[model samples]
Target: MTVASLEYNGKPVVAEELTPEAFKKFGYVISPKDQAPKIPEGTYGMAYRLSDASIPVNNYGNSEFKTEAPCAFNLQRFKPPKALDRENKVYNLPNVERHPYTTQTFFPMGVDAEKAAYLVVVCENDENKLPDLSTLRVFVARGNQSVTYGAAVWHGGTCSLIDQLDMTMFMYDNGVKADEVHLVETSGLRIEYHL
Candidate 1:
Protein backbone atom coordinates (compact mmCIF):
# COMPACT_ATOMS: atom_id res chain seq x y z
CA MET A 1 0.00 0.00 0.00
CA THR A 2 1.17 3.52 -0.80
CA VAL A 3 2.27 5.48 2.25
CA ALA A 4 0.05 8.38 1.30
CA SER A 5 -3.02 6.20 1.18
CA LEU A 6 -2.61 5.13 4.77
CA GLU A 7 -4.45 6.89 7.63
CA TYR A 8 -3.29 9.48 10.23
CA ASN A 9 -2.28 12.13 7.74
CA GLY A 10 -0.11 9.37 6.33
CA LYS A 11 1.76 9.03 9.65
CA PRO A 12 -0.61 8.91 12.63
CA VAL A 13 -1.70 5.70 14.38
CA VAL A 14 -3.98 5.73 17.41
CA ALA A 15 -2.48 3.85 20.32
CA GLU A 16 -4.71 1.42 22.18
CA GLU A 17 -4.68 0.21 25.77
CA LEU A 18 -2.25 -2.66 26.21
CA THR A 19 -3.96 -5.98 26.76
CA PRO A 20 -2.78 -9.59 26.79
CA GLU A 21 -5.14 -10.60 23.98
CA ALA A 22 -4.22 -7.69 21.75
CA PHE A 23 -0.43 -8.04 22.26
CA LYS A 24 -0.25 -11.80 21.88
CA LYS A 25 0.72 -11.54 18.20
CA PHE A 26 3.95 -9.68 19.01
CA GLY A 27 4.97 -11.36 22.27
CA TYR A 28 4.02 -12.13 25.86
CA VAL A 29 2.70 -9.54 28.27
CA ILE A 30 4.12 -10.15 31.73
CA SER A 31 1.37 -8.66 33.84
CA PRO A 32 0.17 -9.41 37.35
CA LYS A 33 -2.71 -11.50 36.07
CA ASP A 34 -0.43 -13.78 34.10
CA GLN A 35 1.96 -14.15 37.01
CA ALA A 36 -0.68 -15.03 39.58
CA PRO A 37 0.43 -17.75 41.92
CA LYS A 38 -0.21 -21.05 40.18
CA ILE A 39 0.30 -23.04 43.36
CA PRO A 40 -2.63 -23.67 45.63
CA GLU A 41 -0.79 -22.36 48.71
CA GLY A 42 0.21 -19.10 46.95
CA THR A 43 3.20 -18.83 49.26
CA TYR A 44 6.01 -19.21 46.71
CA GLY A 45 7.02 -15.99 45.00
CA MET A 46 7.29 -15.32 41.23
CA ALA A 47 4.92 -17.95 39.93
CA TYR A 48 5.97 -17.49 36.29
CA ARG A 49 9.20 -18.58 34.74
CA LEU A 50 10.64 -17.93 31.26
CA SER A 51 12.27 -20.66 29.28
CA ASP A 52 12.72 -21.86 25.73
CA ALA A 53 9.82 -24.27 26.26
CA SER A 54 7.42 -21.41 26.82
CA ILE A 55 9.02 -18.68 24.69
CA PRO A 56 11.96 -18.25 22.32
CA VAL A 57 15.36 -17.79 23.97
CA ASN A 58 18.70 -17.44 22.16
CA ASN A 59 21.29 -18.86 24.55
CA TYR A 60 19.84 -22.27 25.13
CA GLY A 61 23.17 -24.00 24.65
CA ASN A 62 24.93 -21.82 27.20
CA SER A 63 24.74 -23.08 30.76
CA GLU A 64 23.78 -19.65 31.99
CA PHE A 65 22.39 -16.80 29.92
CA LYS A 66 25.28 -14.49 30.74
CA THR A 67 25.36 -10.97 29.43
CA GLU A 68 28.48 -9.62 31.07
CA ALA A 69 30.83 -11.37 28.62
CA PRO A 70 28.94 -11.43 25.34
CA CYS A 71 25.41 -10.09 25.59
CA ALA A 72 24.36 -6.68 26.95
CA PHE A 73 22.26 -5.71 29.96
CA ASN A 74 21.16 -2.17 29.49
CA LEU A 75 19.44 0.09 31.99
CA GLN A 76 17.70 2.59 29.81
CA ARG A 77 16.15 5.78 31.11
CA PHE A 78 13.44 7.23 28.91
CA LYS A 79 12.34 10.81 29.34
CA PRO A 80 9.02 12.12 28.17
CA PRO A 81 9.14 14.02 24.93
CA LYS A 82 8.42 17.72 25.01
CA ALA A 83 6.07 17.60 22.06
CA LEU A 84 3.77 15.12 23.69
CA ASP A 85 0.72 17.04 24.86
CA ARG A 86 -2.11 14.52 24.66
CA GLU A 87 -1.99 10.89 25.64
CA ASN A 88 -3.72 9.89 22.43
CA LYS A 89 -1.28 11.61 20.11
CA VAL A 90 1.88 9.87 18.91
CA TYR A 91 3.73 12.63 17.15
CA ASN A 92 6.61 10.98 15.31
CA LEU A 93 8.30 7.67 14.80
CA PRO A 94 11.65 7.73 13.07
CA ASN A 95 12.65 4.06 12.96
CA VAL A 96 12.14 0.58 14.33
CA GLU A 97 14.50 -2.16 15.48
CA ARG A 98 14.36 -5.87 16.18
CA HIS A 99 16.44 -8.72 17.54
CA PRO A 100 16.23 -11.54 15.05
CA TYR A 101 18.03 -14.26 17.01
CA THR A 102 17.11 -13.23 20.54
CA THR A 103 14.09 -12.42 22.64
CA GLN A 104 14.21 -9.02 24.32
CA THR A 105 12.55 -8.13 27.61
CA PHE A 106 11.84 -4.67 29.00
CA PHE A 107 11.43 -4.51 32.77
CA PRO A 108 10.18 -1.24 34.10
CA MET A 109 11.83 0.28 37.16
CA GLY A 110 12.20 3.51 39.14
CA VAL A 111 8.87 4.86 37.95
CA ASP A 112 6.44 6.81 40.07
CA ALA A 113 4.02 4.43 41.75
CA GLU A 114 1.05 6.72 41.30
CA LYS A 115 1.34 7.58 37.59
CA ALA A 116 3.66 5.77 35.21
CA ALA A 117 2.98 4.75 31.63
CA TYR A 118 4.82 4.20 28.38
CA LEU A 119 4.19 3.60 24.71
CA VAL A 120 5.00 0.46 22.76
CA VAL A 121 4.93 0.15 19.00
CA VAL A 122 5.26 -3.05 17.01
CA CYS A 123 4.97 -4.20 13.40
CA GLU A 124 5.14 -7.45 11.51
CA ASN A 125 7.49 -8.29 8.71
CA ASP A 126 6.21 -8.44 5.19
CA GLU A 127 7.23 -10.96 2.50
CA ASN A 128 10.32 -8.87 1.84
CA LYS A 129 11.46 -9.21 5.47
CA LEU A 130 10.72 -5.54 5.99
CA PRO A 131 8.37 -3.94 8.48
CA ASP A 132 4.81 -4.18 7.20
CA LEU A 133 3.63 -0.69 8.11
CA SER A 134 0.08 -1.84 7.65
CA THR A 135 0.43 -4.24 10.56
CA LEU A 136 1.72 -1.61 12.96
CA ARG A 137 0.14 -1.42 16.41
CA VAL A 138 0.57 0.95 19.33
CA PHE A 139 0.08 0.14 23.00
CA VAL A 140 0.09 2.10 26.24
CA ALA A 141 1.80 0.22 29.05
CA ARG A 142 1.75 0.87 32.80
CA GLY A 143 4.63 0.85 35.27
CA ASN A 144 3.93 -2.55 36.72
CA GLN A 145 3.92 -4.22 33.31
CA SER A 146 6.84 -5.76 31.50
CA VAL A 147 6.87 -7.03 27.91
CA THR A 148 8.96 -9.73 26.34
CA TYR A 149 9.12 -9.44 22.59
CA GLY A 150 9.43 -12.62 20.55
CA ALA A 151 12.34 -12.98 18.19
CA ALA A 152 12.28 -10.89 15.03
CA VAL A 153 9.40 -8.70 16.18
CA TRP A 154 9.83 -5.13 14.98
CA HIS A 155 9.59 -2.65 17.87
CA GLY A 156 10.29 0.95 18.58
CA GLY A 157 12.29 2.45 21.44
CA THR A 158 10.94 3.11 24.92
CA CYS A 159 8.66 6.12 25.31
CA SER A 160 7.62 7.36 28.71
CA LEU A 161 4.47 9.27 29.51
CA ILE A 162 5.70 10.67 32.77
CA ASP A 163 8.76 12.84 33.30
CA GLN A 164 11.18 9.95 33.46
CA LEU A 165 11.42 6.15 33.45
CA ASP A 166 13.96 3.40 33.97
CA MET A 167 13.75 0.08 32.17
CA THR A 168 16.09 -2.84 32.40
CA MET A 169 16.73 -4.44 29.02
CA PHE A 170 18.03 -7.95 28.40
CA MET A 171 19.33 -9.37 25.12
CA TYR A 172 21.92 -11.78 23.75
CA ASP A 173 24.76 -10.90 21.45
CA ASN A 174 27.94 -12.59 20.20
CA GLY A 175 29.75 -9.59 18.76
CA VAL A 176 28.08 -10.34 15.42
CA LYS A 177 25.99 -8.22 13.06
CA ALA A 178 22.99 -10.47 13.48
CA ASP A 179 22.27 -9.24 16.98
CA GLU A 180 20.07 -6.32 15.99
CA VAL A 181 18.55 -4.83 12.86
CA HIS A 182 17.17 -1.32 12.43
CA LEU A 183 14.77 -0.13 9.76
CA VAL A 184 13.97 3.42 8.75
CA GLU A 185 10.98 4.73 6.88
CA THR A 186 12.02 6.07 3.50
CA SER A 187 8.73 7.70 2.61
CA GLY A 188 8.85 10.23 5.45
CA LEU A 189 6.02 8.44 7.16
CA ARG A 190 4.96 9.59 10.63
CA ILE A 191 2.20 8.09 12.76
CA GLU A 192 -0.12 10.30 14.78
CA TYR A 193 -2.75 9.11 17.22
CA HIS A 194 -6.34 10.23 17.65
CA LEU A 195 -8.74 9.68 20.56
Candidate 2:
Protein backbone atom coordinates (compact mmCIF):
# COMPACT_ATOMS: atom_id res chain seq x y z
CA MET A 1 0.00 0.00 0.00
CA THR A 2 1.22 3.54 -0.83
CA VAL A 3 1.63 5.97 2.07
CA ALA A 4 2.05 9.56 0.85
CA SER A 5 4.42 12.10 2.44
CA LEU A 6 6.65 15.00 1.39
CA GLU A 7 10.45 14.72 1.41
CA TYR A 8 12.64 17.78 0.96
CA ASN A 9 15.49 17.86 3.51
CA GLY A 10 15.54 14.12 4.07
CA LYS A 11 12.78 13.77 6.64
CA PRO A 12 9.27 12.27 6.73
CA VAL A 13 6.62 14.98 6.25
CA VAL A 14 3.39 13.31 5.16
CA ALA A 15 1.50 10.10 4.38
CA GLU A 16 0.11 8.95 1.01
CA GLU A 17 -1.92 6.09 -0.43
CA LEU A 18 0.00 2.85 -1.11
CA THR A 19 -0.94 -0.51 -2.61
CA PRO A 20 0.73 -3.93 -2.49
CA GLU A 21 1.42 -3.81 -6.25
CA ALA A 22 3.02 -0.34 -6.14
CA PHE A 23 5.08 -1.24 -3.13
CA LYS A 24 6.20 -4.54 -4.69
CA LYS A 25 7.75 -2.67 -7.61
CA PHE A 26 10.52 -1.54 -5.34
CA GLY A 27 10.71 -5.00 -3.72
CA TYR A 28 8.24 -4.39 -0.89
CA VAL A 29 6.13 -7.48 -0.25
CA ILE A 30 3.31 -8.34 2.13
CA SER A 31 4.15 -11.03 4.66
CA PRO A 32 2.11 -14.14 3.95
CA LYS A 33 -0.60 -14.73 6.54
CA ASP A 34 -2.54 -17.78 5.33
CA GLN A 35 0.21 -20.36 5.61
CA ALA A 36 3.21 -19.60 7.77
CA PRO A 37 6.43 -20.09 5.77
CA LYS A 38 7.28 -23.74 6.29
CA ILE A 39 10.19 -24.02 8.74
CA PRO A 40 11.04 -27.71 8.72
CA GLU A 41 11.60 -29.28 12.10
CA GLY A 42 15.34 -29.40 12.89
CA THR A 43 18.11 -28.33 15.23
CA TYR A 44 19.53 -24.81 15.35
CA GLY A 45 22.59 -24.08 13.19
CA MET A 46 26.15 -24.55 14.43
CA ALA A 47 27.59 -22.11 16.96
CA TYR A 48 30.88 -20.35 16.41
CA ARG A 49 33.08 -18.58 18.95
CA LEU A 50 33.68 -14.86 18.65
CA SER A 51 37.33 -14.49 17.69
CA ASP A 52 37.65 -11.03 19.20
CA ALA A 53 37.89 -11.76 22.90
CA SER A 54 38.54 -8.14 23.89
CA ILE A 55 35.37 -7.05 22.13
CA PRO A 56 33.45 -7.99 25.24
CA VAL A 57 35.13 -5.11 27.17
CA ASN A 58 33.54 -2.53 24.90
CA ASN A 59 30.37 -4.53 24.15
CA TYR A 60 29.63 -5.50 27.73
CA GLY A 61 26.83 -2.98 28.26
CA ASN A 62 25.44 -3.21 24.75
CA SER A 63 22.26 -5.22 24.18
CA GLU A 64 23.00 -6.13 20.55
CA PHE A 65 25.39 -5.28 17.73
CA LYS A 66 26.70 -6.18 14.26
CA THR A 67 29.85 -8.21 14.48
CA GLU A 68 33.01 -6.31 13.50
CA ALA A 69 34.09 -9.13 11.16
CA PRO A 70 31.44 -8.81 8.52
CA CYS A 71 32.82 -11.67 6.41
CA ALA A 72 33.16 -13.99 9.35
CA PHE A 73 29.49 -13.76 10.11
CA ASN A 74 28.16 -14.55 6.58
CA LEU A 75 26.88 -10.95 6.43
CA GLN A 76 24.99 -10.32 3.21
CA ARG A 77 23.12 -7.61 1.31
CA PHE A 78 20.86 -8.05 -1.74
CA LYS A 79 18.34 -6.55 -4.14
CA PRO A 80 15.02 -8.07 -2.98
CA PRO A 81 14.49 -11.20 -5.08
CA LYS A 82 12.05 -10.97 -7.99
CA ALA A 83 9.36 -13.21 -9.58
CA LEU A 84 10.57 -16.47 -11.26
CA ASP A 85 13.85 -15.96 -9.40
CA ARG A 86 12.29 -16.33 -5.95
CA GLU A 87 13.31 -19.82 -4.79
CA ASN A 88 16.67 -19.97 -6.54
CA LYS A 89 17.63 -16.44 -5.50
CA VAL A 90 16.98 -16.54 -1.77
CA TYR A 91 19.64 -14.70 0.26
CA ASN A 92 19.99 -15.37 3.96
CA LEU A 93 20.52 -12.39 6.25
CA PRO A 94 23.45 -13.27 8.49
CA ASN A 95 23.68 -14.54 12.04
CA VAL A 96 20.44 -16.13 13.31
CA GLU A 97 20.96 -17.36 16.84
CA ARG A 98 18.92 -17.89 20.00
CA HIS A 99 18.54 -14.78 22.14
CA PRO A 100 16.53 -13.03 24.81
CA TYR A 101 14.24 -10.07 24.08
CA THR A 102 16.00 -6.84 23.12
CA THR A 103 15.49 -3.90 20.74
CA GLN A 104 17.41 -3.20 17.55
CA THR A 105 16.87 -0.48 14.91
CA PHE A 106 17.70 -0.76 11.20
CA PHE A 107 17.63 2.03 8.60
CA PRO A 108 17.56 0.70 5.04
CA MET A 109 19.20 2.68 2.26
CA GLY A 110 17.17 4.98 -0.05
CA VAL A 111 13.49 4.08 0.46
CA ASP A 112 11.75 7.42 -0.30
CA ALA A 113 8.04 7.49 0.34
CA GLU A 114 5.61 8.93 2.89
CA LYS A 115 6.43 5.76 4.83
CA ALA A 116 8.42 2.54 4.33
CA ALA A 117 6.76 -0.60 2.97
CA TYR A 118 7.86 -4.15 3.79
CA LEU A 119 6.91 -7.39 5.51
CA VAL A 120 8.17 -8.78 8.85
CA VAL A 121 7.22 -11.79 11.05
CA VAL A 122 8.38 -13.92 13.97
CA CYS A 123 7.86 -17.68 14.60
CA GLU A 124 9.45 -20.47 16.62
CA ASN A 125 9.31 -24.31 17.05
CA ASP A 126 6.70 -24.83 14.32
CA GLU A 127 6.64 -27.78 11.91
CA ASN A 128 3.28 -27.30 10.23
CA LYS A 129 2.94 -26.94 6.46
CA LEU A 130 2.94 -23.32 5.33
CA PRO A 131 -0.53 -21.91 4.89
CA ASP A 132 -1.79 -20.02 1.82
CA LEU A 133 -0.62 -16.45 1.23
CA SER A 134 -4.13 -15.03 0.67
CA THR A 135 -5.03 -16.13 4.18
CA LEU A 136 -2.08 -14.38 5.81
CA ARG A 137 -1.61 -10.94 7.35
CA VAL A 138 1.04 -8.94 5.53
CA PHE A 139 2.51 -6.41 7.97
CA VAL A 140 3.63 -3.17 6.37
CA ALA A 141 6.32 -1.35 8.31
CA ARG A 142 5.66 2.38 7.92
CA GLY A 143 8.09 3.91 10.36
CA ASN A 144 10.42 2.23 12.79
CA GLN A 145 8.41 -0.53 14.43
CA SER A 146 10.24 -1.72 17.51
CA VAL A 147 8.89 -5.23 16.92
CA THR A 148 10.63 -8.16 18.50
CA TYR A 149 11.10 -11.28 16.34
CA GLY A 150 11.38 -14.26 18.64
CA ALA A 151 14.52 -16.42 18.66
CA ALA A 152 14.74 -18.79 15.64
CA VAL A 153 11.82 -17.07 13.93
CA TRP A 154 11.61 -16.96 10.14
CA HIS A 155 11.31 -13.42 8.79
CA GLY A 156 11.52 -11.46 5.56
CA GLY A 157 13.73 -8.54 4.45
CA THR A 158 13.21 -4.83 3.82
CA CYS A 159 12.27 -3.54 0.37
CA SER A 160 14.85 -1.63 -1.60
CA LEU A 161 15.35 -0.04 -5.01
CA ILE A 162 17.37 -1.42 -7.96
CA ASP A 163 20.60 -0.04 -6.55
CA GLN A 164 22.63 -1.44 -3.69
CA LEU A 165 20.89 -1.20 -0.32
CA ASP A 166 22.65 -1.25 3.00
CA MET A 167 20.80 -2.05 6.24
CA THR A 168 22.16 -1.43 9.70
CA MET A 169 20.45 -4.48 11.25
CA PHE A 170 20.54 -4.91 15.00
CA MET A 171 19.76 -7.95 17.16
CA TYR A 172 19.04 -8.23 20.87
CA ASP A 173 20.45 -11.69 21.51
CA ASN A 174 22.09 -13.17 24.57
CA GLY A 175 25.66 -12.59 23.38
CA VAL A 176 27.89 -12.54 20.30
CA LYS A 177 27.04 -15.86 18.68
CA ALA A 178 26.46 -17.12 15.11
CA ASP A 179 24.44 -20.18 14.05
CA GLU A 180 25.58 -22.30 11.16
CA VAL A 181 23.66 -24.56 8.74
CA HIS A 182 20.12 -23.25 8.25
CA LEU A 183 17.96 -26.29 7.47
CA VAL A 184 16.14 -26.21 4.16
CA GLU A 185 13.85 -29.08 3.15
CA THR A 186 14.55 -30.97 -0.08
CA SER A 187 11.24 -29.62 -1.33
CA GLY A 188 9.79 -26.25 -0.19
CA LEU A 189 7.06 -23.71 -0.70
CA ARG A 190 6.86 -21.38 -3.71
CA ILE A 191 6.53 -17.71 -2.68
CA GLU A 192 5.86 -15.01 -5.25
CA TYR A 193 5.45 -11.28 -4.56
CA HIS A 194 3.30 -9.41 -7.05
CA LEU A 195 5.43 -6.70 -8.62
The per-prediction CA RMSD against the true structure, in angstroms, equals: 6.1, 19.1
Candidate 1: C-alpha RMSD after superposition: 6.1
Write one digit per residue (lDDT tens) for candidate 1, span 39-115. Answer: 56655776665453225467524424334325567989878765455465554665667766678888889654334
* Deviation from native of the Cα of residue 149 in model 2, angstroms: 2.2
* Candidate 2 ranges beyond 4 A from true positions: 1-76, 82-105, 114-124, 127-148, 156-162, 173-186
The C-alpha stretches of model 1 lying farther than 4 A from their native spots are: 1-11, 33-56, 59-72, 81-88, 112-116, 186-195
Candidate 2 residues 1-195, lDDT tens each? Answer: 111111212221122223334333222322222112455568377433323211111222333344442211213354654522333422222212222322223444344433433434222333442212222222334333223333333333444323444554544333344331133221122332332
Candidate 2 vs. true structure, TM-score: 0.35
The lDDT leader among the candidates is 1
Q: 127, model 2: CA deviation in Å?
A: 6.8
Judge candidate 2 at residue 116 and give its lDDT: 39
Residue 172, candidate 2: Cα error in Å is: 4.0
Going through the candidates in the order shown, the clash numbers are: 6, 16
